[model samples]
Target: MTDARATPPPAEQRLHPWSWLFVLLQQLRQFVVPLLVLLFAGRRGDAGDFAEWAPLVGVGVLVMVAVLQYFTYRYRIGDDGISIRSGLLQRTQREIPFARIHNVALHQTLLHRIFGVAEVRLEAAGGQKPEAQMRVLGLAQALALERRVRHRGTAAAAGGGAEAASPAGDTLLALSTAEVVRLGLVSNRGMIVFAAAFGLLWQAFPERAAADWLQGFFREAMGYAGTLHLGWIGMAAAATATVGVFLALLRLLSVALALSQYHGFRLSEQRRRLTVERGLFARLRTSVPPRRIQAWFLQETLLHRWLGRRSLRIDTATGGREDDPRKLRELAPIAPPEACDRLIAHLLTEAAWPPPRWTPVPRRCWWRLFAGGVPWNLLLTTALAWNFGPWGLLALLWLPWSAYAAWRQAGRLGYAMDARLVAVRGGWWSRWWRLAEIDKLQALRLRRSPLDRWLGTASLWLDTAGAGAMSPPLCIRFLPQAQARALYAQLGRMLAARRLRW
Candidate 1:
């Protein structure tokens, strides 16, 4: 937010002078590791000249392409929208109105910060890519563009005075160092990072399987450890200790990364829009109005409960590219229960925050949920007992665990709705609450599995915009057939005359 009477930005402009350098860096990032891997493989294979020349040629081509982009791209920032023109041989043009642009983000890596420039992305709905992407721009100009996009057309007339509010606006949430550390503890980000790297390695070297390395490692290590006169018990203990140490190291790495990414995390509200600025070395700043939020997720893991913290996330109408720093996914990475409640109240005034009451699924669903996992339990126990003699019969312990889990989970499965909003909650240990406005839902499906048909039960699924393929939708499962049909019909009637928000 800034002064309402500020001078207007220039209509037409080129990207920052260092645009080519940033573009080259971005291109090189995607191929640098792959080229290095190839070089290493080639050297091992005794192809020295090819190994050395390959990276050189790749970098040269990337440089030429980056330079060409810098010379060809041009854009105009107008009062109502932005017009972008690019390409030489196949010139492509895009005109995005400010009203249509739901998200505006600015990204600054360590190098960009040093150079006083940022990458700006403007994203609208109904696209797999951002509407406009400026690889490099002065930070001030980028912020100005974001402001213009926010206060555009009719909004400019109605909310022009709100721009004069304090530059920082009203602080909604801010994370302290301790809170960030708690977030690291609650998250499994270290494992995610390790898995991503392992997947990348597999992509680069298809023949190299993790099972081969692990099997060979255990065989060799067992033989060597046996030579030291340590029996099976000692080897088991040592291996367990090693694994524990490795997990500890991973957690420490996660903490370090969390500190870097969310060190200065702050979320604030200004002129009816929410702005979040975070990251230490690679800063990201994004702004979006509450209306853009399609769905809300409230999560509390075992660790979150232990630390007295919770996380809040939202699905927005912008493109669902998690790799893109421009997307604002986590509204609150970690906060106390009270703060989360306040946040929900502030942003979604119409929705019930704590929900006056919760309706648990029918008692018969407990048996349904419990029976669903029984076969897997028996299969696991049978396989383990067959492989490990009497000792592996410990797998039978899973039977009681699954029973209790199903009972607790079925007790927790429920949905609550008012005229304007709908919410569903699930899970026992790692619980989640999913909510969306009644009018914002894109689709409603009534699912009936074979078991459901046999038992005369049904499931109702609520689909909303901005949800990814992997993210589970709001599902209220295992209800009496008549009740499920009633809910489906009632919600359908409510959705009939109203236009979807996203």
Candidate 2:
């Protein structure tokens, strides 16, 4: 009776023209190393001459693919959701409902910036990859789409209403240039970069060449000091000074990199969503819904504590993987202790500060924790004794310090939970305080190792979806079995009473 052909087609849209170049560049980056390897691998003379043309051929093929992709890809945004049609030979279509959209992230690369376009990524809960993405869109168009999605998502969650109101809050926190510098100083980014660079160099070049280069540089420096006729003690001091200077330079480089990445970092909250904008070149704009946040961590390194500063990071459920840089997990990379407190208070209105009581781990657990370090100390002592004879016996001195450190850690280890929030505090030298909403908890694990069983104790782990595999869940270790059970039951009751927002 009714012909489907009579129905009007959904409005379709294409990505910015610059997206062709973006896609081409991405393909080249992905294939560059393999192409280079094929071109250079054991090739000589004529073979190398042919290889030289290979790159151009590869580029031509990539350009053709990019152009084809651009022509074939199309997306439709309608009242209910978004639908995408893509691929050339093996065509594929994907439809995403507004209710399933988790977060929309906007990113700009150097190329995008030059062309005044942005990349938009759509993340969905429990997804291993972005649900959908547009390589390039006009900046205004991307923002409008993001706002529309957010409005639709909010309305859908609220059981239908007028479009959600526009973001309605002032800037909560803004980082100054000085604070950005502090972030660099407090971060170990330089060491990470240097280590990565060294690893790549070692892998690419001959091991002997790399080793010789490092040895030669150090030997030349030492030889110059030798000309000063310094005694053995003085030579040792010089070496130490050199190492210290090198470390300082590394730290400086780390700081510089931080400065470049987070040059104009700004954090603002509006309509229960947090916005973070940062980056010197490849600018990023991230929006985080309050319900999506799984937990918050307040971290203070020894250096940070000395400077009376702290950093705030949040774990969100929408992040794809640990290595995703676009996640925008840091709330405050560097801030004054007082400012951090204010931000925490603003975000978690239900949680009280200076919590009414902190239940410390049993003092008896100190020896249990301390004894765990004994084997490592013994190993060190054995190595010293083997290499330095009786002088190595001095390594035994570490036992007392280790014991004291363990004692301090046991004293510091504590947990507090209320109807709405659960807080865990621990750390040896650098302190970390983790807070999570009771409703956000997804699972609970209880375990007792052989030694723990002997000690009549158990450990409780509170699991949340926000934590990555490498990031341990909230753990309360060395608690009496009875107490652990009691706390677990209490938490279960709290979790049952509240509906999970994420």
Each model's TM-score, in the order given? Answer: 0.87, 0.91
lDDT, residue 228, candidate 1:
88
Quote the lDDT for 352 in model 2.
Answer: 81
- 110: Cα error in model 2, Å: 2.5
Model 2 residue 41 lDDT score: 63
Q: Worst ten-residue run, lDDT, model 2? A: 156-165
User: What CA RMSD would candidate 2 show?
Assistant: 4.2
lDDT of each: 0.84, 0.82
List, residue by residue over 376-472, the lDDT tens digit for candidate 1. Answer: 8778878988898887778778778878888888878888999888999988888999888998899999999998899898999998887643255
Error of 1 at 387 (Å): 3.8
Please report the candidate that would top lDDT against the real structure.
Answer: 1
Q: Any runs in candidate 2 off by more than 4 Å, and if so which?
A: 1-10, 42-52, 153-169, 384-395, 468-472
